[model samples]
Target chain A: MTKALWRRPEGMSVVFILLSGLILVFIFAPLLKTVTSSGPGTLWGTLLEQDVYTSILLTIYAAFIATLVGLFLGVPLAYILARRSFWGKGFLEGLIDIPIVIPHSAAGIALLFVFGQQFLFGRIFHGLGVDFVNTVAGVVIAMMFVSLPFLIDSAKDGFRGVDVRLEKVARTLGASAWQSFLRVSLPLAWRNIFSGSVMMWARGMSEFGAVLILAYHVPFMGHYPVADSILVADRFASFGLDSARPVTVLVILISLITFITLRTIACRGVRT
Target chain B: MIKIRALKVNLGDFWLEDINLDIEEGEYFIILGPTGAGKTVLLEALAGLYPISQGEIWSDGREISHLYPEKRGMGIVYQDQALFPHLSVKDNIAFGLKFMSYPREKVRERVDDMVGLLKISHLVERNPSTLSGGERQKVALARALATDPRVLLLDEPLSALDPETKEGLQGELRELHHRVKVTVIHVTHDFEEAVALGNRVAVLNEGQIVQVGTPDEVLRRPKSEFVAHFALSRNILSGRAGDGEDGYTMVDVGGIEIRAITELRDEVHLSLRPEDILISRQPLHSSARNSLSGVVADIIPRGAVIYVTVSLPLELTCLITRQSLEDLELRRGMKVWVTFKAGAVHVF
Candidate 1:
């Protein structure tokens, strides 16, 4: 009788539905609680604050720039990882995922050694009128350092999914290597790359440890250097939990909306 | 015309060595080999897809062994029909023409011409993912031909299709070649396909060219033991050869003496095709030089033909129709007579 019940579709579906319901509730309960805890007036008031709005905008802009840079730099490496087999390939692949495994603050310190004012790259950029210490560039570099693995790994899987024969066929059809990549490989891998970019952007937005160590006050509006996470941390430290909650709720609401919008666009793009 | 001189390719685990061939202009040449025989590798080498460790490829009096695949002016079609899935059928057909820097109107005209030629007009607007296997292959062919390549390379283009579809495409390929008059280098393992399509067939074994001849020459007069086995000559016997009566060479197989028409003396290998051997219940009065009476040792039925193995001190498998099997009431352990003409025996 137990075996028969196990084989029944309704019995199996009931267990699946119950387990899935637990995960959905677990994910939504905290968001729902926080969103409802704040009054509408307080949420609107937080949204209207210049410091809050500007810092949120700054965070979004920095993450967007970081994502674009990651796309530009990571895709070629991803394609190479996907297509070629050589000595130390495994070591190189593991190196790409190192940021994900290490602590974010540790990752920040590691980034600092290279991008700090005293380092070679930092000194070079400093000489070029671009400063990395306590600047927007530092924030973007920190975000990119922590979240680039998502983009590279996803893009590598995307390129791996595309058959190499397609590229070979394109070559035979009078397309140069670069042309084939643009016409065939890139387009075929667009969906994965787009999703990876979104993931990297989202991860960059929520980053606190790395951003705090690298750029505590990211310059914005050509005046102040205050990022969203840094501002929220400051509010909580000085004015306590109630002062921090409104801005936190505002940031969450904006991020959730943007992420959903991007995800929906990706899904529609796949369908059509 | 294309000529390959001492072409050698080293693919680490698999390699092609000392390969030489002269493919004439406007000929449907076949590179025939079994699986893992490096047929695709040789074709890829010709198309400049693989780096040749040593060799020269001359096409139309121009050396092209070092040219890039795109600059070689050759198109290749694979068995899987690697059409760009992101593009529509029309776009896939026009992909190469776009790279050639043709004007928009010329590209449109060329795409239309290709679609009309391949009879894929209705499928022009559809995505490649939605097409059938045969339809996808047709689109791949059209895409390759749109560039007006000097030589067309086909890597087992019909091997992936169902038998009926394969036959239909084979006929279309012949017709297409005739209409387009493009020099084709088609690779396949099927002897029947080679015979039906190839102007001349080059048999490859273990990365080396074993024999190059017309299909009949390769099939009837295989120069090596590998070719004899690979060509499906089921009855191969190693024996001593000596002069016999009526200008025939008598081959001593074990204790059985079989007469063959050959000048090869001493030890020799003879191949007799199963279809050439006739089976009967009694000895027939005919001009066939060799006849042996034996008991039917085994009876195996394949698709439409049955293999009847007779033991006359040596096992000889002969192919007969199902109707013949039923008419003769042949069964295992039944006595039977096997006979074939001396001319049917091929000695090497």
Candidate 2:
């Protein structure tokens, strides 16, 4: 059976098999090397470090905050874009795609112009004792600015996949607009929205350029730490590949565990 | 009662213009049209799902042209049934009741009532995705009816089912309407379904209503050549009026003489429904004044009905029940008498 499965007549093309094998090896080799380069003891020791643990915690919580804010603002915009046609709709969709094309550094600079201390909205927030400069708000906003398109676009696709007739049926069934959305459209689009949220959260957690520019130093869980992306970069720059390899492997393992768990839940959600 | 006047709607390339309709209370009104005739658009406009460019809609002595759909007290069911996939059958049936603020126990009781009403008690715990197409349709109907809306809008609700399932659901729908007595506006392209369910029907073509009347009237007297071909699927023939005797006019159709009850001009078009003509081995003796001897050219069985083509110099298609065809022992090249009342001929 194994011999017949590998035979040419089993329908695998030689060229496709060769090219796919090459690409898979190219992608997996680096990940495998990184994981094995550092001993399991060294990775465990790094995870036990208070500063390293706090940095990872800060990155996750900041990304989580950013994702929650993204849901409040992005999901409605996605629903509107999916359901209605109005003037400038084409231009608005183009604007949503603009963030993905621009450099992350440029995006950070643009956010700084609107959110820096001297700006009007920034000063108003400053008066309320909520500062963005080197604060958690700064990290969240910077991450949200860079990662929101994933949430909005994915949610829009999810909403578009739902039949408009379903919403109309809800409306005629004595459900108000908000009720219909909460009861019908939201549940049907939930799996895609959830997957998109996970992507946005993961992307925000690994954000480097924006967080480095906006908030590089902060007291996270009583330890002065930056985002994990910045810490990894700084360690790589200062100590070279040999010293930074363990932290990189640790981060990859943590991301993989979370991604797998959440993705499994999302896939299961769509079926049941 | 529901009335629409001068209703005009524009949805990109498709548009409905100068539409007017009056539906009696508790009547099962069918909007019959082929695809892209704007039947769904008109129904949606009436349901307040789509905004109309121009028109006033009045229901029950109140003008509700701009009222929101939820406030209008109407329910709509799509062809695919559009049941909430995430919800169980019981929860789906209870969805609209949540908006109505019914107590939890009352909601459950009402859901049970609807479940029983639709004969879907066994499916309460099942997911909509797990149900069969007919079961999904029943669940959708139950959900729509749970709120007890003043009017129900059905857009080809049975079009997606198999033949046997569709027939079963059609009977169920008729029974449901008879028991509930809610005003319904059903949209469909199937003329047989329209005839079976509609108390009155409006024939729509190319974004306009061609005619509106009782099913008997619309099927018996189609106003235009389009309706003659589309709505009734009648056999039409062009002929000239030659002479008259008593209350009938003799029409010369392709060298064959036929009598008609309507007053005739020099040139006229005639429509005769296939089912109105009866076939017999010998000449039919009765009040039918138009009997012609013709040879059976073909016999085509369509489900329970058969379309028999008889060539009486001018070939005409006549419909007969398969049982009658078998009883008459109809066969190709057999000589038969085709008889129809002169009044059955519609002049256009």
Candidate 3:
């Protein structure tokens, strides 16, 4: 009886495996079907198209610029959130996370109110010869506003993991506040910050709703500013599913390859 | 020299209140306390890590109450050995020197000197994560001392080590202090550690300094009941005191009358060190003022010594050697005589 019981599969384990397998299939089936549906010639033709390739490059470039902006502005805020306790700290954290929970298009509308030509900030930037409506800068701002929380939250967790005593020791060793942060805290938290930047970059590249509302045609090659998501949507809307399928497949393939490479680099960076 | 006058710090739930100390140059001073006694807080305050709510800290006649920690000329090492994980051990030792005006070669020389002095030269190339507890602590010490701060603050630097490792590091710390002649402020909850390392020890209870004196003075005559208990005096009894013959005050503990040399009267607490009491088969004529015959309650064998509790209506613990315990064949319920001199009793 004991031998038979040991040989039998546990009910819970079987059930768990079945449930997990179902989710895996649910996630991978559509992606595999979409890639396989397009032939190699069609994918190559889609990549060869000037509009398709330029839009893809524009999307990647805009996301990179947005990530740089996030790093410049978000790291200090992350450090503060991790280290110091003050009034309204919780409220401030909640405010940072509001973009993650709210609808991206709604967020874009909110951004437009602040950065539009008639608004206060928009007027100030306009004085500097920068216009937000239907520009590359608008696309970057939209991407950054939606994807900043990933970088900030990850960096905050990293900084929080460091022992405060290390900084105190550094201060006693003749390091100023900034020196200690640069030498000790920053080096220790670089991995988290790096991975977070990657996450923000990836999120920015895939952003559609916010970019659609903020800048449908972001200037790229020559005088035309066209976005990848907008082009795909336009093709589908004008020429149906069959016409847009190749470009969609090309975009997915490029994004997956870039995202996987970055993720691998991040994992290796953490290991070392 | 360092002097702290009326130093007060408020850390929300914990507060160090009205702390005062005068540490001499090159002196090995210890801050002794129980857990949550605000000992580390006091050390951090001295290091200028915490803002002083009220008080003055003067170093070499300069008031540094509001100075930044980096300007205070003090180096602190924590028990956790907070070595930067990303930096190699050599870089960790050379970390502070880089911030100084020293040239690159000078920084390297200073790092080398510290490594040699701490005998961590072999481990200099290794990561702190790969080091043993003792090695990590040595590296921490080397890192702290490389900057040549005027004062060295060690917060339970040896508490996390095993007994053998702790003993080795304790010797190294003493030798290092002798060689460098920097004023050291060490904090620990272990009374034995304070006695072993400190030239002068200060006892902290709650948030206040209860007593400050030499190790002998603190051990022989603790000023407060809390100190007495913390110092490992096992027999603390509450009683009523009255005038007795020969200038000896008698205390009535439970139903027993114990004689002690004190001017205190009325209700009092008495601290009697276990080692001060003599346990024997029979009472003999001695210079001791108190002798009571009682039944042996328990015989607890600690390392090197045996603790025998005797109940003369009120139980009192006395320390005896293992040989004596065996030769006397002491067991539970055996009648024994416990005696101590009136001078051995500490009344508070």
Candidate 4:
């Protein structure tokens, strides 16, 4: 049988192709079964319960606010980083990626230090009566800090996708700098920016540590707080570590749908 | 009228210095320069895309050095046919007429007229990228013309097209300028395109205006060495001065004498375009001032233009017409007398 397979030239390459295919199937089947069984309705009634619904809704809303800020703020920063030349630019780029590299528990403690009522920014927000230390706004700020670079870097790639010649031609035809940018540069770069926003929102929705540090009481009340949050000034922060946060489960579902939809529409990944 | 004085720019690899010239109202001015000589930069500066470090540009008696491109009242077409890809040919032609200062309703009328003038009416609704190279060039030219700009600057406009298309568009360009009477400054490298379309030619080399005059004067009489070679003169000879009437000098060619007029030096260089020289198998009595006997070295056929090189005793090359080919029974190694008028022998 081995001699017969080798003797036929066209039949030889087919055996190795099937072997690699069988290996991929061997690796993926059990992993897929584990995920499929643990999905929304299968494990517990937390999937459709009212308390679960509230946690899921709050996560989505907070993620949305952070993503909106990322869309307007991070995109322009990303585009500038991609297009312009300046001293200390590499340092600035490294700063944007800092949140991704830091430990999540450490990120939570960092968020509390600056956002506590004793801090200057916390006092300013306290005067506005919109509390950041224990509200949805605190949750969003935490998500924004961790997930912003994804939005900006992706948007920068989008803006760089447009040809500079098209803008030059527009200028010669009487289009001003801002006018040319709005007309020639923006429309061509829209899709990539949209995909970047989707990715940022998905990342933000899945954030738990920073939000737990700043606003643990929103999800847990006077329970055993996570050890790091207990060290912070915020009360009841110890409850988070063992509280079984429902928002994480809801965030996972929303992100799964979002990932599928965006991947289909974005078609190609943003090129750096 | 368009006038540029001492235009200078140092754009790294490409440089231009001391470029100076003026085209009268309704004149077709062509600037001929090789690639990377800052020709496009000069045109772009006039159109206000780049800052001219030192120079003054005037259009219609107004100094427009500091004005905006649209305010400068100039239209420029690039070699790439840089039409707006998103717009139809009709809209591309009408693109510039929508400034807050310009009339919107008047745009359509002008676009229609210019498109019809360029005979691109059928392509009015087509996207610019869909059009052929020739069609795109006409659209670009039409777009530039539609605004009724003070002057039109074409940067190597036809050099991008096929031969047949370039010649056809060349004729259309001459007619377009004649009918519109818009002062034009066309930049090109093709000598025939320059001669065919230029009311005046400015020969640019290494960033300087080497020579500028009417087609007959510049082609027949170039002032510099590079200009003589670039205009593709057949023979440039050194001769000791010989005296003639009307302050003309009879230049001493080796073993033969030819007469020409000059305001130049005693040791002068005489330029003769290949087409100006006539070839005959037998030496004959003629009105031409000087004739020399030589052997035919080679025959070169250049599309509608035939180059017959007659190897004179002093390695002289004479260009004759295709129609005169059979009349003179010209062939390689055939002994012939290359005859040219003394006045036609330009000394500079």
Write down the lDDT of every candidate, Cα atoms only. 0.92, 0.89, 0.92, 0.75
Tens digits of lDDT, candidate 4, A1-272: 35544555456689888899999999877545544544455335655544455555666777889999878788678768777779999999998889999976678788777777898878888888867777767877888888888888777887787766556556656667777667766766767777778888888877767877777645433232221222222222544522333333333445667778886787664354
Score candidate 2 by lDDT: 0.89
Clashing pairs in 4: A224-A238, A224-A239, A225-A237, A225-A238, A225-A239, A226-A238, B242-B250, B274-B319
Fraction of reference contacts reproduced per prediction?
Answer: 0.86, 0.91, 0.98, 0.30
Please count the clashing residue pairs in each candidate, in the order shown.
Answer: 2, 0, 2, 8
Chain B in candidate 2 has what TM-score?
Answer: 0.94
- Candidate 4 lDDT, B1-348, residue by residue in tens: 878888887776656888788889999998887877677887888888778889888888888888876577778888888887767889888776665355666777777788889999999999987999999999988877776778888999999999989889999898888899998889998887999999889887777788889887778778876788778886888887767765667777775677776655567787887777777877768887777888988888876667877777676666656777767777789888888887787787
DockQ (C-alpha based) per candidate is: 0.79, 0.80, 0.89, 0.32
- What's the TM-score of chain B for every model shown? 0.97, 0.94, 0.97, 0.91
CAPRI-style class, candidate 4? acceptable
Model 2, native contacts kept: 0.91
Ranked candidates (DockQ, high to low): 3, 2, 1, 4
Residue-level lDDT of model 2, residues B16-62, one tens digit each, is 98899999899999999999999999889988999899989999999
* Predicted structure 3: clash tally: 2
Score chain A of each prediction against the true chain A by TM-score and list the results. 0.92, 0.92, 0.93, 0.73
Candidates 1 and 2 compared by DockQ, better number? 2
Report the Cα lDDT for candidate 3: 0.92
Model 2, residue A235: C-alpha shift (Å): 2.1
